[model samples]
Target: MIVKRPVSKSLARAFFCIVLLSLLSTGVALLTLASSLRDAEAVNIAGSLRMQSYRLGYDLQANDPQLALHRQQYGRTLDSPVFQQLHHRWVPMQVQESYALLHDRWRQMDACLARGDIIWYRQNIASYVAQIDSFVLALQHYAERKMLLVVAICLLGFGAILLLVFFTLRRINQQVVAPLSALVEASRRIEQGRFDHPPLETRLTNELGLLGRTFTRMSGELEKLYRSLEESVAEKTLSLQEANRMLEVLFHCSQALNVGTIDRRCFRHILQLVREHEPVSSVEMAVGATWRLQEGEALADAPWQTLPITMQETRFGELRWQGETADKPSPQLMQSVANMLGRGLYFNQAQKHTQQLLLMEERATIARELHDSLAQVLSYLRIQLTLLRRAVPEENRAAQGIIGDFTRALNDAYQQLRELLTTFRLTLQQADFPAALEEMIEPLRAQTAATIQLDCRLSLLALDAQQQVHLLQIIREAVLNAIKHADAQEISVSCVSAPEGHHAVYIHDDGCGIESVNEPEGHYGLTIMRERAERLGGALTISRQRNGGTLVSVSFTTLSGEQTAGRPDNNNDDND
Candidate 1:
């Protein structure tokens, strides 16, 4: 089955014939098409002759001053290079004869026009136009004939190539492929230490046939030789296969564990890989009481071997395996895998903790920056507005009202800046979302006499740190709005999951409802809330409840990239 020659001479000759035939036909067809490119030009020129003949006839009757120019144009049209090609010998006899007749008639018509014989010119114009029409038709027919010739040449060439390919393939299949396939089959059986396979094709007179006969004779000798060492070969082969399997398992386990961080999913993946590659009927990994991943049959009473997934004194998880096979994975290999898992988990926690610290540091820096710059400016503005209000006359009620509005707006801006600074500082306090939410609400609760309740059912939702931050900010915004605007006694902040895996945070207050959800000119509370919701791939809604009070809800699915729908009352009333 080992072919030394790159290709057979016969195949080379066949390919050469195919390529040569293809090139010849393509060249001829291209030449024909190129020549026909001018056929359209000839037809267009001949067609123009009819229109010129009619114009000239009209000029003779009208005695137009442009008659001389029209006559010269007509002559040029008839003698154009495209029409001159009609005189070539290769042009059909019908086309050539038509052009000649049209030319002679045009000359006579020119004589009549030159002599000012209006009557004779009028009579001959019809016959002259008829000849031009005949010439145009003839040119069209010639172009079509060339197109048909090109098509015929292409079809013949394609058919010749197809037949050549079919013949070559059939010969290769019969003479080369068949004999080689039989020889390969015989060699395969001999490699497997099997000799009672089908016989090889040795009747043909070729190198392949010689190989087939040689294979048949060699297989007989090998059968005798293989019979002597078959048992020992099987034993060695099995042992090698087992060793290779174990090595492969260890290699893949290392690769799977090589990540910047590991999660529960990664732990489950490692367990699954162990079950697939090792000769184990079942595998389980337990990392504390929360994350337990198992693969294969679960037999509680079976004798399970345990490997501690530990690094030094710290233990991250446990790996257990159970199987009835005598070829169980070695204890050393299992322990190595367990150690890798432990290191992966340790690194995962360390990386997360480090990232959280970095995030907190960044938040604290931003808070300090805002407090020094924007917060100081807002405080100055509030003091200036108070001074302006004091300077306003108490007698001018209109001036007093305007100053009052300015004072309220300035105070609102200052409050919002302080709240923002608080938000940034609060996030640095706790990395856990629930703890952060509690801290964020504690200060707000102190500002109002309202009873604030926190119901967080976030056990089913897995939120990353960024998502947690955005969600907490949105809740804080809604809760602040309730406390400042909604004059209520009870405010409920609930974070719950829906049956469809959607998580929502609802801040409801039993107070007077908001007239409009739109923030006033200098306010951006609702706008900031919406932006934060969008960052979480969610939507924010601020609507009035049926009885009274405002309900602000933000809903989003666990799966990212989806925009949650929000239905808020489209009240356009201005906030006074």
Candidate 2:
């Protein structure tokens, strides 16, 4: 493995330069001081020459025999290593000259001592001593200069070291301290979830610089990751909200369909819920071939998405939505709604069937009770009146006439009771409103040679059971009135939606119009018809047409549509 060395411009290199400068300065100072160590010793040896000269002069004056020994000692002292160093080339010129002169004087003194020339030796001894003093003074000056040189080297080295240390410290602050501080601050920023701090310093060639660069890159990546995480979280939150909305809509749909009878209003309410929750412009539902419920604007040319409403493999119809293509509902949600609608339809059919059965059973009970009670009583009263009339005498014509009136009234009452029984026993017989109407008219058609036509447009109204019954009774009574009283040759029964949100039933017969508005005695056909119309929350009108016919018309509203009213008893007799 190749390990990278630190660059020369690094903090370590700066410190190394400072240390090297200090070492060089100290070594030079020590070397200069060591070279001047012998200067003081040389001066001491030179000063002793004065003492040796005095000793030799005294020996010559006193004729001492030990003078020769002292002379040898002086020669040895003059040739000492410390004094000989003055003759080398590094010595000052004045010091060298003084040493040469002192050496010459010493040799002359030694010669004079051997020749016994006391006068010459004594006269020149003081001058030779002066020359030795001059050599010592020169050596002392040289030693002082060496000391000053060492001091200068020490000061220069100290100054250079100080300068280098200052620069090195500044470099360390820039390369290490500043970058470290930035990195620490960067760490804090990241901790605080902020990644937009100032740029860090990476220009340096040290470890700190590399760390700064790496940290910068890491922060960039972290910012990207954090942004991505934020985006993901936002998306998840939106998805959760959408899911919650969808669940709420589905829950409401279930609530609406949970009823026993699902009407157009319920289906319309479901469509309204979808419109509120979804981004739809309009919505519509088609049940069977004729029933349709819609909410919002009806745009015929708008593109629509259709979902089949099916349950148990029986498709009730289709649900359609009109809006922007991008605003389509979830297939799963729409399908679920469709399935719920299908189930509701199924339940509605079953409930209607049950209600029809119950209605028929109640009607039969009423008819049976009437037959067992009112009819039997009416028949017995008619027989008793007949026998009493037979028992009455031919005389007393007023009483006889009264008996005849009573007998005729009894017969009319019995016939009316039988008609009531038949009407009470009538049922829908698993037929729709139109079919029931047709069945009621079929018998009347035989009673008249005139063509009896039935025109019905009640599909759009979708009348409930009570509505169907009241409407059927009203139409049947009008048709019977025309057949019995109007003497019409042609009759038409029509049921259709009227303007201003109402349904109207019309029974028109082309026959001689009624001569009087008041019904005769014991006849309540118009009264009963008006009462039924009032029960239906409508107005019934019997008017003579200009073409010599009577028109009986009833106009009313539906509960699910514009208007409605409380229902009357379903067992009301069709007395007409």
Candidate 3:
């Protein structure tokens, strides 16, 4: 069982009281001693006077015969002279009378002794001596009484001082030492983590009680703070753990998406992964102008049109999704899905076009056979007709006219076949991106009379062939839209490396600001630009410049040197 201690304030107050009481007691003792000393001095002075009076009477008796006789004669008349003066001034009235009689008797004896009267001298001398002895006895008694009184007072003062000291010590122990000891114990308990115990309660309504109350309040506050701090730390630790788990999940998802080839299957897998980790309702793929999901069969509540999908100039499809609930997806999750879809589309387009190329190659071979054999035979027939026209020439005007018309018809047939062959050869091929961009802008410059400048700062060798192609396509569409729709006087196309370690293409057109158009049309040009950028794992942004112009920008990561070979196919006919 441990006991709490009292506060320091109580001890300090008790000590102050002790010191005050001690000073008061000491002052009182000194005053009592001084008064006693004064009384003793007065008593001593009285005793000395009585002794002096006795000595004077004796001297007068033993003096010369003549003077002694004169003293005897006047003794009866002492009231009239020196004896009267001495009696009146030096002693009390009662003692003065007694001394006067003694003096008279002494004078009578002295006068007899001087006249040879020894008998008278003896009798008077004995009587006077007795009276003087009695007087001296009275004085001695008075002095002894005064001395006894002073001694009694001194003893009383000593006893009082001792009692005060004892009481003071007891008070100090009760108010200060005892309480302080208890306070020390309480502090020890507090140090040992026993905050449940309260401090000792001092009942004195002074500083001691105040200190006790203050200590109690402080202890309570400390306990509350400790508990609150512990709870806060626990909550923060749990929050950190949850955040770490979320980060781990995000890391796993990133790794899975970054590896492997991108395709429709991969795209679906990514959606599934997102749904498993997060919360997604449905996903849809749109290729060209066609929605992969048929009408009334979308996974989400709204129709496919409600999704953010653009149809016209879209090079490849988009995968638009929403959360199962009304909540929007996290921006981080959305960006991740966008990147995965871009890479997936790139691979899908390459595979689709590779298959298309095979079919086109077969068709081209058949067309070449037809042109080489059947067309050659037809050519020979036309040549034979030409020769026949020359042979019948001289005077057969109708025959000559017939041969010329036949030759003209055969030449027209040959021209048509050549045109068909040329169209087939040019069907799937594309020109170099920069050259293609230059070509598209030439016509824009001619039509708008705009000064269009192209700044191609990007190193073509640094970009993968596929990225280069998409970048150029995005730029061409952006420039065309700005020049035609924006109605600009000047257009600037710039391609450079983005500060964020990506390639960027920017198109600025001096035109009416974007705010001027209350509602911009969903032109295929913008859609195509977005699709091309997305397909290359890039982003496209459009904004009205502070000045009167429209600005279009695209940014995409550049592939490393080793990964640049075998460019991804862009044979996506899905222009929607």
Q: Tell me the whole-model lDDT of each prediction, alpha carbons only.
A: 0.76, 0.78, 0.57
Best by lDDT: 2
- Cα TM-score per model: 0.43, 0.71, 0.33
- In order of listing, the candidates' clash counts read 0, 0, 5
Stretches off by above 4 angstroms in model 3 are 1-202, 262-576
The alpha-carbon deviation from the true structure for residue 457 of candidate 2, after best TM-score superposition, in angstroms, is 4.1
Who is ahead in lDDT, 1 or 2?
2
Record all residue pairs in model 2 with backbone atoms less than 3 Å apart, i.e. clashing: none
Better of 2 and 3 by lDDT: 2
For candidate 3, give the lDDT.
Answer: 0.57
Alpha-carbon runs more than 4 Å astray in model 1: 1-257, 261-272, 278-353, 389-404, 428-461, 483-502, 508-516, 543-551, 558-576
Minimum summed lDDT over a 10-residue window in model 3 is located at 288-297
lDDT of 3 by residue, 434-553 (tens): 444565556557656778999765532224334555665566656666765777888899876643236678889898856642333422346666877888778888889887899888
Candidate 2 deviant stretches above 4 angstroms? 1-23, 60-68, 84-101, 108-127, 148-162, 235-361, 378-415, 429-464, 478-493, 498-500, 508-526, 543-550, 558-576
Model 2, 1-576: lDDT tens digits are 121434444656777887888899889989888888887788888888889889988898899999999999999998998877776687788888888888898898899988889889868877887788888788889999989988999899999988888877787787677888999999999999999788998776667767788899899999999999999999999989878888999999988776656666677778888888887788888754555777788677888889998878977688998874566777777878888888877676566556666766777888898899988998888888889878888797988999899889888888777767766676765335676678777877888777889998765236666666667777877787788878788889888764333778888889898766677888766777788787677888888888789888998766652233233445444323
